[model samples]
Target: MRAAGRAAPTSDPAADASDLRVIGRVAPHLWPPGDREARARVVAALAFLLLAKFATVATPVAFKYAVDGLNDAAADPRAVLLSLPVWLVLAYGAARLASVGFNQLRDAVFARVGQRALRSLALSTFRHVHALSLRYHLGRKTGGLSRIIERGVKGVDFLLRFLLFSIGPLALELAMVAVIFLVVFDLRYFAVIVLTIGLYVWFTFKVTEWRVKIREKMNAEDTDANQKAVDSLLNFETVKYFGAERREADRYDRAMAGYEAAAVRTATSLAGLNAGQALIITAGLVAVMAMAAQGVLQGRLTVGDFVMVNAYMIQITLPLNFLGTVYREIRQALVDMRAMFGLLDQPPEVRDAPGAAPLRVGAGAVRFEHVDFGYDADR
Candidate 1:
């Protein structure tokens, strides 16, 4: 159920408020829910998530064991150089498969949780819009209003999946890896992993922050271009009578030119961000590998342990490569969803009294006093 004293959500996406505020506004509809089944599904989803993390963390270790067994076989004169340990190989494959299986199970379980939340929000928004005063409907564009709600609806699903699956699971896996290193290996190895991760994350945040502005520019220009084209085409007869087709085309081209420039910049900035993040991971891998090599040469670690280090780093770095992009999109999702969420902050133009009654066919005339709803007045 909703927390106490929160503003009621409206259908207007332009309602301005913080993400937490917006989420709180919709919280009642999604959680501490009246439906017991939904809560169960949420619990099941969390359980699956934990299972997935366990499997993911174990996968690298399994592969390491397989590699070590093969290394031993190679050194034995009685054995073939490429002879494989059947059980180790099977365990490694199982680890990989189990991780994927658990991940998919989590998604399947959580799908209902997300869908229910979206449905509730969408229905609430619909009812709120219908309850609004006629002036509110007259003042808003149907296309813009629809797009805002659509984005907001889809945004909830995206937010849930990204935060729960991508960010949460990856973090848990990282922690598990850190623990494994501390318990079974060296502190220096853990430090290398941690340092590389810290640098990679720092670099990603800095670059992604820069990209956020570029995205804003691109979105603004793209909207302007689309709006200009729509307005011009919709008023084609007026433009014909005024002999302004060429003028319309020029304005449209100018808007598109701005959009084109912004789009190009976005592509270029994304490439740079990817390259910088890759470099951070590469350096981290080299440092971790060096430590592993030193340990192996000193007989402090087995050949298998060295291979495990590489496997774990490779696995960790693979997901991290997309972390920046995922984070950026998550931020954008909040922004897109904010408009609808912000509606909660808007006070309605009309509301019934405590003892209000539904209007009847012969209801008395409506009356108002001391109201200043000028066309230009901010709502």
Candidate 2:
């Protein structure tokens, strides 16, 4: 499940999280793993995000002039037409450049981050698996733990990508919408848009929280059912000896039925989440469009200004939706992190004294003074 590597043994998850280790916890260890050149590449990529966002918002402004100039042919037909092509070309070129830059950065960041994460997880799991007492592995399912590490590392990658690139632009665009309104339209209109967005986000979180809990429960149950089936398969000889094929099938069917039921519930919750997001976005767009129209009629907002508002509205919604997705992923990543921390918390069975003298070379002698041993059935 994991590639070759060397990492310190895993600690108990709780202990890892709680330990006063000033270094490890403070640094999430998920940053891009490239050296100096890689760091430069990541910085360049971030610059691209800013450029992309600016280019994106700037396009509508260019169109506004194109529209106004085309409308005013009597003012100077040739001049207007000449400027139109230039503006269109610049806008298109800026957008295309931004697209190329953003993609390159995204791939570079994900690749670096993913490689580091997988390498770390592989080494950590390998070392930790050895550090743990034989009892721990005997009781735990190796396959399940392997899968968890694989998934947890991917989750961390997702978090880093979304947090680094998507989040900043999302916040900036929302602020831009408010700023544009305050500059060109009424404060009241900006307030309305801001308030609506806040409420929508609040509602989305509450609904998503409930759905996540339900999904987690469903996942746990599904895992249990899967484990049972795996056990049966591994013990096929015993099952055949008992002539319990039909019985095993029945049990498998029951597990599958429960899994399907949980899956349906999860699907339903996801559908509701999408619907809620759509409604919230539509309502916010309508409010902004209405305000823009009012501003235009009152002669406070120009046609270009209206176009800017529409662009801002789109910018706001796209990121808000993305923010919701990011938030959910972050929450999942945190949960995975907490589990990892919990694993790190498990104390080692053997530890050195706080301060001890170095051993001197001498003839070996075996000694077992008052040996004691016990085993817990539950454990």
Best by TM-score: 1
lDDT agreement with native, every candidate: 0.75, 0.65
Q: Candidate 2 on 1-379: residue-level lDDT in tens?
A: 0011111112346533443342244243544454665565556666777766666656666666655555555477568557664566567567657755775666665566446655676577567657888677677775456556655566556556665666666776667667767766787778878877887777767666666655566556666677667778888999999999999988878877877887777676667777777787788888888888888899876776677677767766766766556766655655555555566667767666989888897999899999999786786
In terms of lDDT, which candidate is strongest? Answer: 1
Residue-level lDDT of model 1, residues 265-290, one tens digit each, is: 87777677777777888898998898
By summed lDDT, the worst window of 10 consecutive residues in model 1 runs over: 1-10
How much is the lDDT of residue 263 in candidate 2?
Answer: 75
Candidate 1 backbone clash number: 6
Worst 10 residues of 2 by lDDT: 1-10
